[model samples]
Target: MTDRRGVVAKRAEDLVSGVPYVRGWNRARRSAGALADQLVLLGLDSDFPGLLADVNVFGDGLVHLGTIGPEAAELLANLIAAGLEAEQHDTATEASSAMRREAPAA
Candidate 1:
């Protein structure tokens, strides 16, 4: 069962009828989001702010997985769609980056 926030939705296949099961952009996006949330839970967000952003930035490319030359993009998008946190990672990263300063290299 999915929550009102759509944080936990039924598996994609259950939502679609008579559709062949395919691991695509949608799935990836969801996965990415979920991964983001998991990272937050694990406190990884505090240490690696760019982790989620990279996933989201790459996830955008997933939207066109099946088209010519779109396989890679699709893969990324799918990752984003599968996870909720992954989708919001870019914004979160930007916000955090603005609040943080880089350390001087030794």
Candidate 2:
């Protein structure tokens, strides 16, 4: 699988690097919520763990991000989207196979 969520992940990195600290991460809240909502819709409810992993990886690569808020929160949302996309892709592939087996030949 090529992992189709790479674009979202890249955007998150850009947001993290470019967006200045907002004292309390207010600017990143909406983006974060969007990510979380997308993940939930895609049925990967385990997004928080994946998000934490993503945040830790980001922190390790750069300066420690400290407590997640605002921008960091948005980054978490991106992580969730990435995870959901991956899972959904896999599930869709599986579903295609199942449907093929069940369908009558044309």
Candidate 3:
């Protein structure tokens, strides 16, 4: 199945590169928090490991980000959203069938 969240998170990562500093990321703490909050609503923050690795891979972490403060600490929502989104399937029967297929045979 095509992973929409993965696709969107990747798109967001790519889009972040086009954003600049001074006016892009070098804003006050509150503004950054708001942006982070937006990302939360988009369920993108849960891809942090992949996203951070992508940032480090491109060698533009410093340029793409300034400083993250405590105001942006509400990251659990992203984590929780990951499981909830991942669990979503067409129906309970499909989910059970997939689980059964993956389960070890006794």
Candidate 4:
């Protein structure tokens, strides 16, 4: 399909709908603000971040995903959405936790 958003959303649906372990995909969420912040941290030179900034995910910050191109973007969004759908990740929380855990205590 030529519609980028549709393709992306569909891929995400596929992930959340596949595999026995994916039952957790039903409870994902992401705040548009947190998404924007992550996009900056990721440093990807794509419009995906801007697109995410406009998304209204109600501040959950992981329920949605995006990227620079149609094909690749769809793939990434799905991977993330999959983890989200499966309740295997809270990207922002996970990232921060990992950083904290890995950081050396001064």
Among these predictions, the greatest TM-score belongs to 2
lDDT of each: 0.46, 0.49, 0.44, 0.47
Q: Which residue runs does candidate 1 get wrong by more than 4 Å? A: 1-23, 46-106
Tens digit per residue, CA lDDT, model 1, 11-46: 342335444334444565676567567657755444
TM-score of candidate 2 relative to the true fold: 0.33
C-alpha lDDT (0 to 100) for residue 72 of candidate 1: 37
> Per-residue lDDT of 47-94 in model 2, one digit per residue for the tens?
343342222212221122235446546766787799899999999999
lDDT tens readout by residue for model 4, 1-106: 3243332223332232223323323323235555556656766435464443221112111244443678657656876898787665566678889999999999
Each model's TM-score, in the order given?
0.25, 0.33, 0.22, 0.28
For candidate 4, the C-alpha RMSD (Å) to the true structure equals 13.8
Candidates by lDDT, descending order? 2, 4, 1, 3
RMSD of each: 16.8, 12.1, 12.9, 13.8
lDDT (0-100) at residue 32 of candidate 2? Answer: 55
- TM-score winner between 1 and 4, please give it: 4
Query: What TM-score does candidate 4 reach?
Result: 0.28
Model 3 lDDT tens row, 64-103 = 2324434344454555687687667446769799999999
C-alpha RMSD of candidate 1: 16.8
Cα error of candidate 2 at position 41, Å = 26
- On the 0 to 100 scale, the lDDT of residue 7 in model 1 is 33
